[model samples]
Target: MLAVALAAQFMALLDAFIVNVAAPTIQSELHASGAGLQLVIAGYTITYAVLLITGARLGDRLGHRRVYLFGLAVFTVASLACGLARGTGELIAFRLLQGAGSAVLIPQVLSLIQRNFAGEARVKALGAYSAVLATGAAAGQVLGGVLVSADLLGTGWRPVFLVNVPVGVVLLALAFRVLPRDDAAALAAGRARGLDLPGLVLLGAAVSLFTVPLVLGQQEGWPLWSWLSLAAAVLFFTLFCAYESRLARRGGAPLIAPRLLRSPGMGLAVFRVAAVMAVNAGFLFVVTLHVQGGLGYSALRAGLTFAPSAVVFGAVGLTWRRWPQPLQRALIPGGFALAAVATAAVGLLLRDGGDGGLWLYAALVGVGAGLSLGFGPTLTRALATVRAEDAADASGLLATVTQLGQLTGVACFGALFLHRLESAGAPGAYSSSDALLVCAYALASVAALGAVSGLVRLRR
Candidate 1:
């Protein structure tokens, strides 16, 4: 059961960044502009982030097993559609569908683990889950490069999507055979509670309004419409919050329970996760562009460049349990600090027109170590104060925040990278150096903020 759950998660997370290494290829082959490529990446993340909470609610209301199967089927079909897409527009549309399917699939993995495992067993299951997430992300980069370079049957980047079909089919079959049936009583209770349709709509609208402008603004040369969209995002988000609070006060089940947000550490957790993930997502997206797009490295070489970081990330994650509590708590700020230094070093290396050498690899290792160490620990701390009954809600909200962070990172950094390229007048090793430097400094500032927050919370 753990193996099956991890496999499903692996696939979902893999799709998140697998396209990074392939972005250049897709653009060249499909004649996709920078904005089109950004959509190809951001569209999936946006949909996935927006729908995650709703998907988790559906799992609770329907049944984990049932919802998981449905999501898997949708994901499988979407993968096929993505592979078959003949143009950038078609690919972006299919990727959105794929992201929706993933939102459904991911929450169930955690639900199943909580339902099926107990005590130490549950702890181990969660650890394994985290490992899969880290590994899958790294593997996506490597696997994407291999598929694109292989061009199996002269298919180029199509195989990256096509490959999921068989794996999803096998996982679906295994799930049916191995996963336990739904709890009839829980299903009944969930059915009795109505879905918060209004909350869902408002939340989705707010997220789309905020993210769409980030993606489209620079591409359209920052027209008046983009500023209007940004303003609309604020309005929609304010309205969504007011509506959710009203619903919760009325004893209704809000899309995000107000109580969850009120918990100690919850607000800080959300901020930290958003900041860290933004840097993580932005770093990967920009580095891929710099190495493959600017430096003219092959897909395989670019993918392999990430190997050191990935390995270090996995190692740090696996051994994290052995660290002291203070060390564990400090990991968030410490990790971010290391990542900031690494990013700065990489920017310098690129600006100097030097090939990223041993130092570059070391810096990547720092990034992986910091992010991996910080991620799970921060999540655990964030949910520590929530009641048992609200655990599911807390988990869902946290996951949603994580995805939003990724979306922000991708959209913002992608736009910045493209704009830099245009102003620099050509793609070269140092053309995007200023963008990278800005991101690195921003990360450093965020790390300091995390440290201050941690200290303040302790003093309180």
Candidate 2:
């Protein structure tokens, strides 16, 4: 059962990142526009974020097993569709479907783990889960590179999507046999939602309004609509907060309960997580592009470059809890500072189309080692202070926030990188290096902010 759950998770997280290594190939083959490529990436993340809470609610009311199977079916079929897609529009649409399926199913893994495992067994299950997830995310880049470079049957980048079909099918069979049956009460509740639908819509609207412009503004020459859209994003977000607050006051289970945000240190902790995730996703996107798109590195080589970062990150994340209490506490701030330095070093090393040498690999390792502390530990630290019951809600909210942060990073930094290429007159090996260099520095600044935020939280 644990293996089945982790396999599903591995597939889901793999798709989240596998596209990075294949992006240049996809663009060149499909004749995809800059905005189109951004959509290809951000669309998945946006839909996943918007529907995650609702997905969790569905499992509570409808049965985890039932919803999990349904979601797997949707995801499997969508993966096939994505592989068969002939154009940018088709691929982007399929990607959204894939993300929806993922959202519906992913929350159930944790629910199932909690339901099925207990005591020491549960602890071990969760550890394995975390390790597999960390491995999956890093492995995606390497795997995608291999598949694309292999050009099996001359299919180019399509293999990345198609690879999921068989795995999903096998998982579906195993899950049906091994997944525990849901309680009678869960089924009786049916499709009913305790969801905050209005809040969901408002949040979705705000993100879409904001992200659409970022991805497309340069492609469309920055029309008046872009500015109007960004303005609308701010307004919608304000309305969302007000609505959540009102619901909380009335004792409703508001999406992202306002009281949670109001808790001491909670908001800052959330911001620190968001900043780290934004930098993480943004760094991967731009650097992959810089290497493969601009510097003519093969997809395999490009993906392999991230090996150090991935290995160090997973190792650190798994073992961080073993450190002494004081050292663990200090690690968060220190991790952020290390990440900031490493990120800036990357920028400096790669500024003129030169791949940062062995030192560059060292910087990448530093990035992975540092950000790993800022993520899982930050969550554990924040939750240590929260009441037990609210832990689930806080976890769901943080999950959604991380997805939003990823989408935001890809849309904004990707747009800037694309625009830089356009203004410089056609991308070349060295011409677009500065674009990535600039974005790297910006990410470093965000890392520095996380460091400062962690320090302030420590003082408080």
Candidate 3:
């Protein structure tokens, strides 16, 4: 059961990055605009963010096992669709549905671990789960590259998505046999809460409004409608919040409980987690693009370059709980600082026209990232202090926030990097030096913010 759950997580995290290495290839083959390529990434993430809370709520209402299987079926079939997709539009549409399926699959995973294991056994299971997850995320970059480079069976980049189908099927079969049946009374009572249809529609609208501008802005040359879309995003989000609060107060089943936001520690924890996740996902996206897109490395080489980070991150993540609270809190901030330094160093190396030093920079950032993201345990612990029913709600919210932060981070950094390249012009065009320098400055700025946020939280 644990193996099956971890496999599901592995696929989700892998899906996140595996498509990135194939982006350039995807663009050329499908004749996609820059905006279309970004949609390949953004479409999925936005849907994942918007539907995550609802997915968790559904899992709670139905049996987690039942919901998990349903999600698996959707995800597996979608993976096939993604691989078979012949054009940009088809891929992006399918990817959005893929994200929806993934959202349903993820929340129940943690719930299952918590429900199944106890004490030391649980800790070990969770630790392994965490480690596998981090490993999968890091490994995805390399795996994507290798698969694309291999071009096995003449599949080109599509194999990355195609690969998930078989794995998902295996998991689904195991899930049906191994997953424990749910408590009839608990399941019945949970379903009594009903779906938050209004909340879902409003949240989905808000996400679509927010994402359309960021995605279309770059490709469409930042037109008036893009700005208007941004304005609409704000308005929709504001309306969503007000409506949700009113519904909660009226004794309605809100998608997210309004009271959860009022909880001091949990609120802060979620924000902190969001920040870290934003930086983490952003950094990965930028670095991958820089290596493969900017530096012109082969896909396989670019992926392999990330190997050091993946190994150390898994190791540190496994031992995170053993560290003292003070150290645990500092991990994220320190990691961010180290990552910034590494980013700067990469810039310096590029300025000097040096080669072969990327491994060192990769190591520094990887180590920091490992220790930093290791704090997930602490964040989950903080949220666990909330009530049981609220636990699902809180976790769902945190997941949504993390996904949103990830989207923002990737778009912001990727945009800045591209912007800098455009400004630098051609001939002597945006050298790797200029690009790395910009990446460094951006990362350093975000790191400082993360550090301050962490310190302030500690003080409070």
TM-score of each: 0.91, 0.86, 0.89
Give the range where candidate 2 is weakest over 10 consecutive residues by summed lDDT. Answer: 386-395
Across 33-60, the per-residue lDDT of candidate 1 in tens digits comes to 8888989977887788778878888888
Root-mean-square deviation of each candidate, in angstroms? 2.6, 3.4, 2.9
Per-residue lDDT tens digits of candidate 3, residues 400-455?
77667666777787777777767767513235457756776776667666555555
Whichever of 1 and 3 has more lDDT, that candidate is 1
Question: Scored by Cα lDDT, where does model 1 land?
Answer: 0.77
Best by TM-score: 1
Q: Which stretches of candidate 1 lie over 4 Å from their true place?
A: 27-39, 86-89, 134-136, 384-388, 418-427, 458-460
Q: Which segments of model 3 are wrong by more than 4 Å?
A: 28-38, 117-137, 324-329, 356-374, 427-430, 457-460
Poorest lDDT segment (10 consecutive residues) of candidate 1: 451-460
Q: lDDT score, residue 132, model 1?
A: 66
- Residue-level lDDT tens digits of model 2 in 182-279: 87754564333266789878977887787677656655777999999999999999999899889888887676656667667778778977887788
Minimum summed lDDT over a 10-residue window in model 3 is located at 366-375
In candidate 2, residue 399 scores what lDDT?
63
Query: Considering TM-score, which of the candidate structures 1 and 2 is the better prediction for this target?
Result: 1
